[model samples]
Target: MDTEAHVTERDRSSDPDTREGEGSRSARFLDAPWRRPALLGTACAAFLLLFSTFVMQPFLIPSGSMEPTLRVGDRVLVNKLAYRFDSVPQRGDVVVFDGTGSFVREEPAGNPVTGLVRWAAAAVGLAEPAETDYIKRVVGVGGDRVVCCDKRGRVEVNGRAVDETYLYPGDVPSRVPFDIVVPQGTLWVMGDHRSHSRDSRDHLGEPGGGMVPVGKVVGRADWIGWPVGRWSSLERPDAFGRVTAPGPVGSHG
Candidate 1:
């Protein structure tokens, strides 16, 4: 029996031309000019949308209402999960919330296309938020006596005077004096720039008693995220530390 020559021909795949052709095909497939950039952009957009909806949201200060602490052009990062747990907003924490029925008697329905555009712009802090949204600092929460213009010209919560170091220069604690107890599950909020803000105080006579329901709060303004020079973390001041909890109803501290 003659043994057959067992030499196997060289593999075609090992040929230099075949290898070059394969490489060229791969290069052509990967070199689609727009694919990588488009994918990256889509991923980035999805991440931003998720972050803005459930993690942190970017909010553009639309007016001087928050003033010294949050300038009109300042962009703040709101912690949407701040109060999602058992905890609630505490005194001195700046918050953003819906103003419907409290600050806004009604929200007019707008064109869906326009609404979507507005939402996109607001999401990136490029435009002012909807008219039904407002921002202010929590002065009292859930059954705290919030009094304006104490004997020392300062606001008081639960009978303790607040040292408003964040108040706008030359701005009093409140020019429109009033006294009220923050109802249960609600917040008594005010703008640092008392004179320029139309906050809960402005709607005292309205249906909601100028109180924002805790349920309506969108998030806590935690930091100034834009205008590199203005970047800063927002901290809850010690002013509220001295404030006690709710006392007897209709009692003044």
Candidate 2:
């Protein structure tokens, strides 16, 4: 009788219903119809995020520094690969460059976790860039003489007068006079909205004299990607047409 009672107790404790319940929970996930699609969506989103942060990023215009060309809130697609093969940024090309140690006064902030979030947001064109970055037109390349207010009140590159029809309407080349030759392997850049922009000109008296190194360039702004109404392709302006290349020994004038 005691043996039969022990057997009954073991059967009760090892009931099949309890075992089935555990099995069902384990199988529930496998049986879900939406699992595959959800996983695929997450994978695609992650891939896009990675591609944008480390590869090609979309930068938003927060200020009117590049007005008439890039407005406030406009998002531009930055081509990070453009300068990887080349060693310099060409004149008339709008470029996005890292301003951490060179241009801006404050250094960039954020820990690893926060930086990843910010980078992901910037990749999808939803957030502002974290680093001190600037979008400016390349006025002078390495060894080019870039001077302001020539005889025609225009900015000169290599002693040639550039017709800046692309300048903001009624805007002059510069109100703060400046004359400096761009150093070799560096770039002198300026914003379209010269009056409001704090470009290399603003830093002329600072440490680097506002010249950005070729290595600091992040990418070229290839297109305005957001705000469908403002969508457009960014092209190198032809104003540098008559400008001559630097001489073998560099520009003497």
User: What 10-residue stretch in candidate 2 is worst by lDDT?
Assistant: 4-13
- Model 2 lDDT, residue 165, Cα: 76
Which candidate's lDDT is highest?
Answer: 1
Residue-level lDDT of model 1, residues 102-125, one tens digit each, is: 888889799999999898778878
Residues 1-253, model 2: lDDT tens digits: 4656444346543789888887898799877889879998999999988787667888988889898999999999998888875545889999998887679767756598988777778778888876587889999998888888887799987788899877888899999788788788789999998888889998898888899988989899999988999889999989999999866554464
Q: Pick the candidate with the highest TM-score.
A: 1
What would the TM-scores of all predictions be?
A: 0.86, 0.85
Give candidate 1 misplaced runs (Cα > 4 Å). Answer: 1-31, 250-253
lDDT of every predicted structure (CA atoms): 0.89, 0.85
Q: What local lDDT does model 2 show for residue 191?
A: 91
